[model samples]
Every structure is written in C-alpha cells, then in structure tokens.
Target: MAQLGFEVRDLEIFASRTVADGTAAEIVHREHQTSVEVRDRDGLSFFVNTAEPLESDPAADGRLSVNMLWLTPDVPAAITDLSNIGARLLKTADNGHIADFAAKNSGKIMAHFAKTAAHGPLGFGYHGKVEELLERLLAAGIDAHLIDESYGRTLHITNPDFADQPSNPTGPTIWVNEEDQPDQYGYTAPSGTAPQAARLDRDSN
Candidate 1:
C-alpha cells in the first residue's frame, strides 16, 4: 500500500441561494490551502482547495443540494497506485467524484471481506486489508462514515447535509432519503419500502 498526504486548511461555511428558488442559506463548508502527496506508489500527488459553497434554497429554484468546487493541481498518485495493483481510477469531474467512487468501491471490498471473514483465518486477512485501505482513505482526507443499520454495511464519503433541500421555497429545509433500507430511518422491512423523503419546507409541513 501507499500513503497520500493532504494539507487541509481554511474550513469555513458560506451562504448561497438555490437556483430554483430565490431563498438564501448557508451551503458548503470551504476548505482552503489543501494539498495531497503520494509516496512509494506512482510518485503522483494532488492539490485541492475548497471553493465557495453553493446553497440549496428552494426559492433559488436550484436542484443541487450541495455543490463543492475542487481542482486537481497535479495528477493523483492513487491513479498510479491503482494501476500498479491492476486497478484504475475512473475519470471524474473532481475530488468529490473520486471520493464517491472510492466509497462505493470500498463498500464492495468490505462485502467480500465480510464473506471471507466468516471463514476464520482468511477473514482476518480480509479484515486487515480492509482496515488498511480505510485508514489510507481517511488519511487522504476522505470523509468516510458508517451508516448504522442491521448489517452495518453502509459507508459514505460525503456529509448527508450536502443533499438537503428546503421544504418550501422560503422555508427551512433538511436532508431526507428515500432509500429502501433501514439505517437512520426508523423503519422495518417487509412492511413497506422506504417512503419518498424530502426536505420539507419547515412551514409547509
């Protein structure tokens, strides 16, 4: 495995209006002066800066829950490392895309590890690898979190609030999910699928 260095700085919250609705609200938490370095892999590194945040106010008529702007100052070392390991980094627009891609891939890796772990010896090996990879991701500045559930198998890389929407055009809004799974939502399976969840305009509902 290889190590990636991230210099994180200047974290601040900003306000913006939704494109769809003309309401105003705080949006992204900007991170400034961030840089990532990779060693012993492909000698590639990445530099990032958190740009201005985009809001999700309904009054602004915007569909975007949260919008983060990031740039790759240099080619990512992960790309080379993955290539050496017979994997490749998918093309994406920014770091957020890379983070999402990594999180999803990590989920699949964990699932396989879980299956092997059930066997005993191989399970330990799987767990070790999984832990190592997760640690690497975290050290590389990925925001990974476990979603509580019966299986406890969900891993997310971004904050949930980034997906929230205002309830009404001018009302306070919150993030909601319509996923047909049990985790944060206090619901049971076999009863019904997950209901359509949305950030209701605080005053509308």
Candidate 2:
C-alpha cells in the first residue's frame, strides 16, 4: 500500500482502482498485476505476488503453507510482539528450523511460501480478520495488500522502497497468512500455529 509504505507496484497515483468527480468516474488502475513488498525492523525485505484459487469451483477455497523461514537474533521476540498487534500465532517457531546468526542473517526475515494456497475436501467459507493482521506493519512503514481470492483476500507484500526508499529505523515483521480451511487473506483463522520466522537461505528442501 503506497499509503502504508509497502511498494505498491503500479499503484495509481490519484486512486488505487478509480478516480471520480461529482458526476464523472473512471477506473484509474485498470487491472495492474497486484504486487507489494514487506520489510522487517532490521531493514531486510521480501516480495509477494497476487494469486487466484486453483479450482474454478466457487466452493473450493485454498490455504497457504510455509516454504522457508527467515530468522534474526531477536526474531522470536520480534514475532511475539507482532502476535500481540496482529500476526496471531497459530504455532510458534517451535516446529521450524533455525539458521546460523550472521550479518546476512542479522536483519529480520520471514518464511517464503511454498504452496500459497491449499484446497480442501470441503471448502467451507469463513471470514478471517485479515486487515487486523497486517495493520501493525503500517507503523513500520510497510504497506501490504489484501489480494482478492474470491473467498477472501490474500497478502502480496513487495519491496516498495526496495531500490530507493529511505531506510526505516522502525518496521514490523510481517508474514503472509494463507489458509485453506477458512480462506485466504484478511486475517481470521482456524488457530493454526506458525513456525518461528527465519532466514530462507539457511533452509534446505
């Protein structure tokens, strides 16, 4: 979100989707590929892209799983703080692996998604409190998008100031929450646990 600091790719200047006058209105952002960037407190960042459901069937929704984890010296504490604001902890990092601490791993890091969305036998619909989860990132100057997945919204955070944005002295650690049980995007959940955020380079398939 340009308003929040996350580099909103192809974001319309006047409006995200449209611009209108008293009697005139038009679509300013005519279907730009939705994308964005998210950064952590230490200044490291990652990119995310918009996604759609695997099934054409409306009843079939999807969920997201962690592909890799990014870590920092203070990641556990940082993420715990995030949980208080929003990133509701489904599972703590107890299940994930930890990477060696170093300069490259000094900054905050998060899991890279492997399967962003998971379809299920019965795709029941439920509202996940998506906005609340990523709202904290706003304070960190990292704007994120609640991508439309039909059933709900999915996050697609990219580096907004990646190449030129000023360094943020303070930014929150934000992670993408993709779920199949309830739906994707827009915070709300089945109370699944999340692994501790870690550095991806240290992780192996």
Candidate 3:
C-alpha cells in the first residue's frame, strides 16, 4: 500500500454565530466523526473541513466546552454520498496542499531533489514550494539557507578571517582592511606614507 500524507488546501471557518445556537451545538455533535461537511450559507452552500483534527475540552465553567479543529485532506467518498450530504463535488488535484501547508507552517519547503540531498531518502518527502517558503522566511527576518544537491549542507561564514582565508593556498587570499593599511602586506603603514612620502617630497622640492 502506498503511504499516505495529508495536505490542507483552502479552509473555511464557522462559529456558533453562523447558525442558530441550538443548531450549532446539534451540528457539532452530529458531525463529530465527520471531517468534511456541507455548510448552508443563506441558501447557497459550500463544503468545509478542518485543516487538522478537532478536540473539545471542558471550559472553566462546568456547563461550557471549547473545541478546536484543523482542516486536512478528506477520505474519498462516493459522489452519491457527497450529494446526499449536500456537498458539491469540487474537483481534486494532486497533493500540492501538503506543500502549501508546510510552507505556511514552517516558512520553508524543500523540493524532492533538494530534500534528498539534505536528508537521506528515508527522510521526509520534499514539498514543491521551497522557493516561496524561503522568500517568506527571508521576509520574516528568519535566515533561510539552502543546501543544493551539489553541496548537501548549509554554509555560514561567521568569522571575517574565515571568509578571506584561502581554502587551499594556491593563490593570494583577499582580506578586508578596516584600518586603511594594505591587507596583503600585514604592514602598519601605506607604502606611500611616512619616509617614502617624505623622500618623494624632498626630491620634488
């Protein structure tokens, strides 16, 4: 059997106020086992489901209760059953919802190819919205690092010297000179300054 993963796409929110208070309680109780349902809106209707599982807990007041729900993929149902439930049979697409959900929740998604590199094959499957998720992370001020297939690691160079140091010492390495001295020479003064400048000034005079 193929392993199944759930992805949530669009979601709809319903509060007790949307329906008669008594009807709301009845509906909640009747639909406890059902994740997807058709809700009547001013005689029009739409299908709705929780993005995730729902749970109910007793409130501080003994007589009251609170419930939480999430929307996710729905199990395949017969068209007749769905129609009897008053739900319109909207078309279903491939599992992009999983990627969308991951992007929204984690602020990052990984393509299958990229994911395989960072994590071995046994790791979680990659979602296709990695680039969008990365943009979201960057906009939120979170550092988004990408590990390409060629390099299966996120590289961060925190040390100034580390960035300038030669990887193999085959050629000259570049360094930042914050103090106005030649970084290559390790000298305290510029070659054109002090005695050199004085001698040139003397010669010109």
In lDDT terms, which candidate is top? 2
Distance from true location, Cα of 121 in model 1, Å: 39
| lDDT sort, best first | 2, 1, 3
lDDT of 1 by residue, 1-205 (tens): 1122111122121111111122222223336433222222222332223334556466641211221111222224333332222222222223221311121112100111121111111010121223343465589886654444453333344433344743222122221211223343232222233322222112122
| Model 2 vs. true fold: TM | 0.25
Candidate 2 residue 59 C-alpha distance from true site, Å: 18
How many residue pairs clash in each candidate at the backbone level?
A: 18, 33, 7
Q: What tens-digit string does per-residue lDDT give for candidate 3 at 82-117? A: 223222222222332211112122211112212111
Q: Candidate 2 vs. truth: CA RMSD?
A: 20.0
> Which residue runs does candidate 1 get wrong by more than 4 Å?
1-40, 57-205
Considering every candidate listed, which one attains the maximal TM-score?
Answer: 2
Q: After superposition, how far is residue 161 of candidate 2 from its true place, in Å?
A: 34
lDDT of each: 0.26, 0.32, 0.25
Better of 2 and 3 by TM-score: 2
129: Cα error in model 1, Å: 33
Better of 1 and 2 by TM-score: 2
